[model samples]
Target: MTAETQAAPVVSYGRLVPVVVHFDDLDALGLLHNARYPVMVERAWTALWHERGFGFDGDWEAAGDFCNAVKELRIGYEAPVNRPGAYAVHLWLERLGNTGLTYGFRFCSADGAMTYAHGTRVLVRLDAATLRPTPWSEPFRAVGRELLRRAS
Candidate 1:
């Protein structure tokens, strides 16, 4: 199943998305595969956009062919994730530039006892047709700015 979105009773460091660890996500060592962290983060990112009511169903060209594409991603593993269950992936807007957006993220255990990993991802708005970076739309920028402010 996809990560579930929930309303935070109190907004803390960032927004939280519920992550489900599938059986296949574990490595041979019985812990979450290191490479899977990025995948999980991507899922959380998509959920974040959807939660904010981003229109992703319309024609890409009509929307100026703008799409969010990861320009860079860096993840630091702090602890091993062994059990397969519900977890939380916290995400927040870190910055919004003319042609990019940065987001901070964290992976925590189900009970919040351990922090599995943390990282930052830089995303750029791209013209899908030409595969070139493009400036973000005013509406998109406004939403990003609001998220960043709330994160602070």
Candidate 2:
């Protein structure tokens, strides 16, 4: 297959979480601050988690699936978000391992025709008490499988 075909699958899968770029998030140049990209993506992920009934609401044990730590993050900017408006962050499971998973995301226009930034984040599940890597719970893996991309 061609490179274009291979790269097109991500956009076809996963979910789109809405994001609003407020004026406060802009830099002096009137563009969304470079640092805000990850923050926005994080918020999107949090919202998704919440919608899926996973959150830290004083019950650590119940929220263990949301306790993963970022092992890696990579973002590539393709265009600048020049105005504060409605956009979207597309998220999909890239790789789901025993103790960790990698998510692929794109910060783009609401329709996803214009991509401002794209990246992947690697998160390692942790043992709440020991703070060490631990296998993902079955419930967590089940939810993850819904977002997991199928082989092209």
Return the top candidate by TM-score.
Answer: 2
lDDT by residue for model 2 over 29-128, one digit each (tens)?
Answer: 9999999999999998888788787787776666688777999999999999999988888899999999999999999987678899999999998888
lDDT of 1 by residue, 21-74 (tens): 888999998999998898998887777776666656667776541476777988
lDDT of each: 0.76, 0.86
Q: Give the range of the ten consecutive residues with the poorest summed lDDT in model 1.
A: 2-11
Native-to-model Cα distance after best TM-score fit, residue 99 in candidate 2, in Å: 0.8
